[model samples]
Target: MTLLQAFVTLPVLLPMLGAAASVIVSPRASLQRVIGVVTLALVCVVAGVLLVSADSYGPVVAQLGGWPAPMGIVLVADRMSALLLLISTLVTLAVLVYAIDQRISDYGRETASTTFHPIFLLLSTGVSLAYLTGDLFTLFVAFEIMLASSYVLITRRTSASRIRSGMTYVIVSLMSSLLFLTAVGMVYAATGSVNLADLAGRVGMLPEGLKTVLALLLVVVFGIKAAIVPLHFWLPDSYPNAPAPVTALFAGLLTKVGIYALLRTQTLVFPQDHPSTLLLVIAAVTMVVGALGAVAQDDLNRLLSFLLVSHIGFMLFGLAVYTPSGIAGTALYIVHHITVQATLFLVSGLITRRTGTVSIAQMGGLAQTAPHLAVLFAIPAITLAGLPPTSGFVAKLALLRAGAGATPAAEIVAAFVVLASLLTLYAVARVWVRVFWGTPKEPLVDNDPNDELVVGTARSARGMYVGASSLIVVSIVIALFAGPLSAIASRAGDDLQTREAYRSAVLGPDTAPGGPGPVPVAAVPQGPAAAGGGAAIGAMTADDAEGTTSR
Candidate 1:
């Protein structure tokens, strides 16, 4: 493999290796923390290099262990994967730093040694693998890796509530994985390949009814992960109960992976003349339902969890359009949301640390006592609400433009998007008003020695602030660089639509240009082919053989 290819792969490998090393070495607490930070820092560097290299060299692909495309595992980094890798790495790094400090504060030096470092690194590895894998089956494996690691992290404290939440999370996740596997099996049965590029080529040839069934299955599988509407009951229950940093990471990265997979599959594997209209309706409902849930929540973490679900619908709206602008909007939204959401979660955790609770009713006057924290929270809150001069605004604008220019049905979808944003703003402002502006509802508690901990101390708040602020700064940077980023997203969307570029990039230029080769007009069955041996089966097998020969 070349140097660029190595850079592309290292982000995933570094975390996996570091997790194993952390377990075996049994390092000192400080050393374990160092291992986690340094390993993630290295991943950040590698992701950055891959981003630059991919921009200059175009998409990079590596066939694992010297095997060829159709037979071998491939790790491919296109503009989309590279962009997600960069964002996810940054979020994981920030969360890792915050977790390190939070552990020290909450558990002190003794028990901090147990599982945080190892599990977190493993989680990073799983996320990285999900973004890098080039095919469907491997993506499923990556999803499982992430799900298993998350289960351990979520239930680490072993409280009754935590255990309950963890069980729900595991059950939901396992069912989704099984659904995904079944979808993959169906696709493979129809197409004879699990490689995404190959599937893209063959998907258009499948019968309409079968395609619709496969598409619906995929939507359910990924929707469960993305926390879309009816499938999102697990999110509010699971996320708020996990440790703060774990919640932050989950908020920032996990659902976005689902979004990524949804976008990839819909755009690449099933690009038909008229895509699923039902997805548009789902998008609208997801946005409205999620925002309404957010509005009703009084607990800070639960509120944000609902907001996360709501914003996921916006991304879905962009993807549901299946146009270049829609896809670009979705990409920009993904990048912006990761940083902004992680920062908000971190800041919320900081509030909980200071006030001893996340219930907004129990907290007040934080701006007076924790001015910096209030400002930190405000930055992301405003951005999340789609305020101007932020990446969030850019993303929302892109979606609005796409929606306005889309089919007449999209105009209604656009109205829902606007309504959702307005509701989101109100929801976030309610949190702001309750937490930062209202009169102190509960007296400052200094009786317990632990409660007497000073606010704004370098030791207590610095690490958390640094982590949150770093992501906040990144969100601003994305806003400033919006033009270039949007261009990259547009190109990525274009590549996804005309997947010949991706197929050639991965499978080599030898394959026929428009896609393997078109099925002969006479070969395509007008209706269902016969189930048992007959002329229809013979024709189907002959068609498959001919297509393979052309390749």
Candidate 2:
């Protein structure tokens, strides 16, 4: 591998390797934390490098073992993918710090010592790989990696509630996975390829009947993951039951992966003439339904969970429009939401920790008890509501402005988007008034139900404070630097909308536009390449070949 290829692979390679190493050091809490932090920090730096490189030099790809295209596992880093990678690692690192310092890990216990760090690192690896991979099956593998880790993480404390929710989460995820795998089968059965660039080259030639079926199939699968409206019922139930930091991590990473997948497949694999119409309907309904759900929630965690689902509609609205300005706005909104949502949840964690309850009905006067926490909560709450002087406002303006050009449909979705923002403001404002502004409602006594979860409140650590605050600072920075970030997002949007650069980058220069045809998958490994690579073309995957079965 060339030196640059090494850099391209580092973000994936380092974290999985670190996760493996973490197991050996699991007996030592300090050492395990060090491994997890350093691994993510390095991945962050690598992701930053890839983001700059992709923005400056165009997309970069590495084919393992120096093999070619669909024949080898390829990792491609484009501006969009790298941008996602950077923010994911940042959130992962921040959430990890919070978990560690909150003493939530219970390090000396075997389960805590053995499971948390390894799964945590593995989860980060999954997010990075999901963003970076070039093929559908590889993306599926990455999703499974994420799912396995998440299953363990969500059920960590083994409460009945946790197990029940985890079961729900798993069933939903498995259904998505099964749909995704089925879609992959359809894609390969139809086009003889699962590599995204190859699929992009060939999908345009497919019968509209097949294309529409494939498009809807992929949308439903990803919709389930992104928590878009009707499919979002599982999220509010599942997220709040996990540990605070774990929930924050889920808020930050998981659903966004689904959104990212939707964005990728929409632009690359399923950009048929009429798909946007359905997307618009989904976006509008998701915004209205999610915001309505948030309006009645008294629990802060569940409330944020609903808002999380609601705001995905904004990104979908941008995608539904499917224009450059629309996508750039979506991209910016995504970066904004990831940080802001995670920060809000982390702040929620702090609120639950400091105030002895997440329910505002019984919670009051937290500002008097933890003034700094009040300010911390206030920044993200206002920002999430799309109030002025924050990145959320910038994101909302960009989406609305983009919507203006898309006419009556975009305009309708835009209205829902605005309504959702107002509802979000009201919901968050209620929490502020009831919890932080009023006098104590019940005196936070030892026997209080809220106090049951507030162990070690007086001794709260700096890591929890600093981790949540750092992301808030990031949200502010994005707001302040909206102009430059918009440029990057615009460039990324251009790349996604224009498939030529990605094709050429992943499949070599001959795969550029105006090609006779996509460089055939068989041709990828024909010269001085593995014979089995060519033989594998248009075949069922190994898991399929081995007869995958539920039981």
What overall lDDT goes with each candidate model?
0.82, 0.82
Writing each residue's lDDT as its tens digit, candidate 2 over 190-215 gives 56667888778666555566668888
lDDT of 1: 0.82
lDDT of 1 by residue, 371-432 (tens): 99889999999999998988899999999998898888887998999999999999999998
Local lDDT at 458 for model 1: 26
In model 1, the runs with Cα more than 4 Å from the true position are 110-114, 443-459, 515-551
TM-scores for every predicted model: 0.91, 0.91
**Residue 452, candidate 2: alpha-carbon lDDT:** 15
Root-mean-square deviation (CA) per prediction: 4.6, 5.6
Error of 1 at 353 (Å): 1.3
